[model samples]
Target: MSAFDCIDTFITGGTAVIELNRPRQLNALNRKMVSEVVEAMESFDRNEEVQVIVLTGKGHSFSAGADIDEMAEDDPIRLELLNQFADWDRLSLIKKPIIGAVKGFVFGGGFELALCCDLLIAASGTEFSFPEVSLGVMPGAGGTQRLTKLAGRTKALQWLWTGERIPAEDALTHGVINQIVSPELLMEETLKFAAKIAKQPPLSLRLIKDSVNKAVDYPLYEGMQYERKNFYLLFASQDQKEGMNAFVEKRKPEYKGR
Candidate 1:
């Protein structure tokens, strides 16, 4: 049984789906929701059956942002103790891939949550924003850092400062989202993509994610070194030999995730 009241989780075909369930509040992220997300992610990471995770909302809006009502009452100390944003860091540390399936409103903390995913697939009519500036607060999560890394400083600064809602097309153009599809096709397309990745060798997927993530934090040469190490290490795995031999035999490789 799930301890979460604000979210729903299930696994299908090696892909786990975590849906924000508070439709009444547009799934606004409160402390409880954040905590539940962290706990669910940790559980999924330990579950060998799950190869990928997809995050979405049950209703029209993916999320409206953080719970303003809760934020208004909480003091700095309380907020610090909650460690809401740190949950995102924990999610990122998971070896398996995470895909955000966004639709409708994705604002403020909601935007930060989507950014935490390895890839994002947005509905055509989805709206994304950083509305914290209007709330007289700034994004406490990795919003600033991750947005800047993805879309560059100028665009990130412009969006954060203005608190404007960016449409799916603009968000994709800005490199915030990987793909955009009709609302009805959002889940289908996202799951299809996740399934493709899930079919790959688990160890290779983990190494690929690790190496690419290093590019953001390490210098060019250091990133290359990390990539090189992972590349060499793959040679020792059974999947690598199977992959090569299958190519030679003109057959599909059966990866056991070794």
Candidate 2:
């Protein structure tokens, strides 16, 4: 019934969701699937109706990894020519927040996909790993860099070199994830958290996301300057005035996202 081969999308009020649909393969991410995901997120990034996005999988696993069958058949030269990682970079361009609601197996490329999100919440039993080391390769996407940024170099090397599984609790303690819940409550809690974020002024959310990303890539002084510039720019928005004036008037402010 869906137009897409690998994903199903739903827009619910201020939150949009993209659900991986390859349950039979444990939601394996093939080129088709990753392409579809980038396409959908780009559209949502441009859509004013969408305030945030929650990405999840339909079945027991978020994704086992990239499609091994597809990879096994690829010639090395052809793989380099295809350059699938270019699509993954587009995810960083999206200005809105993305919350990954992960459960079960989140392995290799799947683990990298979760790392791409602005925030992550996982079901209790979820396992995160990069088994690419055992496969005689390493993460081609931003896995090594991103994980090392958050979890630091020592832990990142330990996990990457050994191909060990990181459970939800361990991931939380190390800052790989924001929250953990029972499997049944994962989506429910994620949506609730997203809705709370959605109620804030749109421009603030956009700028905040941008500033935080700069923090990851920029030096401390430069990041602070970027943050200050965005802070000064927000005063030009209609929502900023409405928010401040409403507080003085002791009334709820209505935001037009201007």
Candidate 3:
């Protein structure tokens, strides 16, 4: 259990909880925090017992964004840290699903962090925005691309260009978030969702996620081809047969990751 000042990482049953511990700073992302986050993610990725990841921050706010005070000194180290933190390869490639439990302020890097997750469940009172434009910078993470893909190019550009805060309801309606629960219930709801996913066949989940993510980067015909191939491949697995048999028998399916 390696612990860092900025993050608290723990495994509970099938889920890995990554908590941002900088409440006084509203869980702002700094170089140390970014390094800790990557470390925690890597450890969770290697742990077979961990099937899902739930990322959230402490206190009323999720995260206010990057630490502006630290960014005051603009140097190569700062630029490199920014780039490393923004890179999707750090977390998005994990086979297990990652869920973001967002509440309060989710601005700039905080917003980008949620965008990195496979699913985002926000509190009804959560505030979301990409204020990098106002700061004379842009979303360094996959935000620009992910937001556009998730909410459409025009909408994404509108939000980014304006640097305005969006409420949870609008975020959900725009596909920026999956669900909106009460602030107090945000963690519980996210856990419920994670547990539900953890109960499914792990192999199927990983394959489906890969297929969709990869297909999205291709042309329509190519994308459908990948989907068809993935569908047929899964059908050939023992888990697929067991799933159907279990349904017929009215019993829970026991998946062996086959």
TM-score of 1: 0.96
**Residue range 82-197, candidate 3, lDDT tens digits:** 67654446777777788999999999888888887889999888999999999888887777988998999988999999999998989999988999898888888888889999
Q: Give the best candidate by TM-score.
A: 2
Give the alpha carbon lDDT tens digit for every residue of 21-45 in model 1: 9999999998789878878888988
Clashing pairs in 3: none
**True-structure lDDT of candidate 2:** 0.93
TM-score list, all predictions: 0.96, 0.97, 0.91
lDDT of all predictions: 0.91, 0.93, 0.86
Local accuracy of candidate 2 as per-residue lDDT tens digits, 144-254: 999999999999999999999998899999999999998999889999999999999999999999999999999999999999999999999999999999999999999
* Global CA lDDT computed for model 3: 0.86
Question: Global lDDT for candidate 1?
Answer: 0.91
RMSD after Cα superposition, model 2: 1.1
Task: Please give me the total number of clashing residue pairs in predicted model 1.
Answer: 0
